[model samples]
Target chain A: MRRWLAAHWRAFSATLARFAGAPLTSLLNVTVIGTALALPLGFYLVLSNLQGLARDYSPQPQVSIFLNIDAQEADVREITQRLKSQPGIAGFRFVPRDQALKSLQSRTGLGDVIAGLGQNPLPDAFVVDAGRKATALESLRAEFARWPKVAEVHVDSDWARRLDSLLALGRYAVLMLASALALALVAITFNTIRLQILTQRDEIEVAKLIGATDGYIQRPFLYLGSLIGCTGGAVAWLMVWGALWVFNGQLRPLAELYGIPLTLAHLNGSDSMATLLFAGGLGWFGAWLSVRRHLHHYNPS
Target chain B: MTQIVLSGVHKRYPGGHEALANISLAINAGELVFVTGHSGAGKSTLLKLIAAIERPSTGSVIVNGQNIGTLRARGIPFLRRHLGLVFQDHKLLFDRSVIDNVLLPLDINGFDRREGTRRARAALDKVGLLHKEKAQPITLSGGEQQRLCIARAIVHRPAILLADEPTGNLDADYATEIGVLFRDFNQVGVTVVLATHDMQLAARLNPRLIEVRAGRLAA
Candidate 1:
């Protein structure tokens, strides 16, 4: 076990030396891989932040049930009781006709005109917070419209439904993009290892001739690939973080326009760890493939 | 005891060229034998067959009691670990320091780092190249590089040592020096098999000689 660990440590250090030997090339390759990975990762972050904003700020799907102008206090109380009993209704608030009239008068700055009319033009209304599903909210609106003394029911959840669908589509897009870029990462590592094998052909042949096992010969290359992958993953994480920081600065004005606090969340610890491991695994696989294909060709003869 | 044996061995390359045909030979433990032949007399093929680098086209080539013809790919490295090989081209890693070239086989075999370095230095000292241990192989002269190859091969202290044209590019002094080195190792009971066309070196060493001509043994 000690020897095994030493051998692996040697391979790892050898890989690091190789990177140090060719810093510019290693850096360029890592940059290319990191940039490619950052595209999907950035999009994913954006979609996640958008979903979070939608969750935090988007109002619940509400159905406003307006009563007839002749609706009495008894009718209002009866409808309130019915709404409370509705299974799908999350909650409801009652606005009496007089309260509604006063609100409109203050909001519109038409207090004198409303007072001159000698009557409250606005009807009593019940705003019901229903679940966010468009179909469920529409059905509830229709049911509320059928209630006695209810003149109309309005569903204000169309824009919310559209935003939800857009976010779902964005999530799918991020997934597909991530899948394609992951393949690109693997291919990049594969080609890099292939070139490394070719350049070290003499060293490999000599090592094999000296009784190096297949595992011994391939360890350094595998380490090289995985190191590149892991470094690239770290680079991608940094790129995403830097981009989010810049984008958040730009989004502050838009968030103020909507009068809501908005900021994109950086990759959590688990997500950052997953990215590094995923990249390292892909790199290891690529190196394995390249070595399996090429190492046999250098038999000591 | 027989350390290597060949019975009815034949080797044919991909282009239908026969490198060796109907050859049979054996060398006992601790024997220093020279394979003498012209440039294309299949001397290297004989060494390669003994080393398990190439299998016989027909019949068996056995080393250390294991038949080379039936050795698995995975078993080849283990077989080779017990044998030291010197190629005609030296096969030294020019990118590494001289000591590193000697340390490779030990590294491959997973010897402890400090122990491997000690052995590597001892091997280099034996070849009189200890002072040049830090220099790159490419900086060495032809004879020095050949010595480096020998140091690398013998660093693991294998039971059998095989050399292909070890003195092919050396001067008379260097060639005699190498021949003496082989004799010294053989005296210490390491079986040595060397292939060469240099009859002068062969005559000077006066060890057992097997001559080959046109892919067949010359009796």
Candidate 2:
């Protein structure tokens, strides 16, 4: 076990020195990979924020039943009782004709115009809260619309449903974009690793001639690929966070216009770790494939 | 006490080119032997066969009690670990400093870093290139570069040393120096096999000479 650790340490340090040997080339490779990775990750962050804001700000669907203007007060009482008994109905509040007109006058500042009319124009109503998703409440609104003595039924917040569908489509597009960028990252790593193997061909041949095993010859290149990948992942993380910082400056005023306290989330700890690990794994795999293809062509003889 | 024993060894490459044919020879431990031949006369092939870099087509090559012809692919590195093999060209990594080139064999063996550095320096000193340890191989003279290759080859202190034209590209003075270095190592009980086409240099060294003509050993 001790020997294994020592061997790995040696290989690691040696590979690190080789990378440090050519800093500009390594930096160029890493920058390209980082930029490729950042596009998908940035889109994901935007989609997540959109989903979050939609959840917090979009009002719930409310089913409102309006009684006939000539219906007796008893009909309003009966409808309220019926809504209370409904299984899915969470709660209901009754608004009489006079009370509705009074509140509308106060809210809209049309009290004098209402007094000049000399009669209440609003009908008695019950606002029912279904306390369920839009789909379930939609059916409740439909049923109430068909009830006797109901002059009209309005389902508030229908715009929430439209926004939900639009957001779902956006999420799907982001997922597709993420997949395409991931494939691009793999191909980039593959090409870089292939070039590295070619440049080190003479070193590998000499090592093999002097009794170095295939594993020994391969270790440094594998480490080179992984270092590039992990550093690229770190660069992507920096890019996303920096973008959010700059974008949040513009987002605050827009969020204020809608009266929602919005703050976009950065990647959580586990998410960041996963990103780094995933990038490093791709790099290791690319290096493994490149080395396997070329090592067969080299023999000590 | 025989270090290498080849019996009826033959090597036939694909496309029907036979490089060695029904050759049998033996060299005892601590013996300095020379394989002298014309180009394509199988001198290099015989050394490669003993190094286990190429397997014989039809016979046994026993080196230090292991049958080279029957060794598995995974066992080749281990066989080479006990033998020091040198090439004629492309022997040094010009990108690395001389000491680093010598440290390669020790590095592959996973030797302790401090101890490996010490051994690498000692090997460089043995080749009388200690003052040039930090120089890149391209900056060294041809003889210095070949000596660096020898340093890298024997850094791990292998029991057998095989050189394929170690002095082929050097002047006579440098060639004599490298030949003397081989003689010095052989005096200390290391089996040395030097292959070359330079008959004059071979006569000067006056080692146990074996001649090859065509694909067979000549008497």
Fnat per model, in the order shown: 0.79, 0.54
- Each prediction's DockQ against the real complex: 0.81, 0.60
In model 1, the clashing pairs are none
- Candidate 1 per-residue lDDT over residues A34-112, each given as its tens digit: 9988998899888888778777767888889999999998998899889888998789899888888888898999999
Worst lDDT 10-window in candidate 1 chain B: B87-96
| TM-score on B-chain, cand. 2 | 0.97
Can you write out model 2's per-residue Cα lDDT over B1-219, one digit (the tens) per residue? 999999999999889999999999999999999999988999999999999889999999999899988888777787888888777884788778999988888988879889999999999999999999999899998888889889888889999999999989988899899998998888998999999887777778789999988889998
Candidate 2 clash pair list:
none
Compose the digit string of candidate 1's lDDT tens values, residues B109-168: 999899999999999999999999999999999999999999999999999999999999
Query: Quality of candidate 1's docking, in CAPRI categories?
Result: high
Off by over 4 Å in 1: A68-78, A110-121, A131-151, A252-259
The superposed Cα distance between candidate 1 and the true structure at residue A111, in angstroms, equals: 3.4
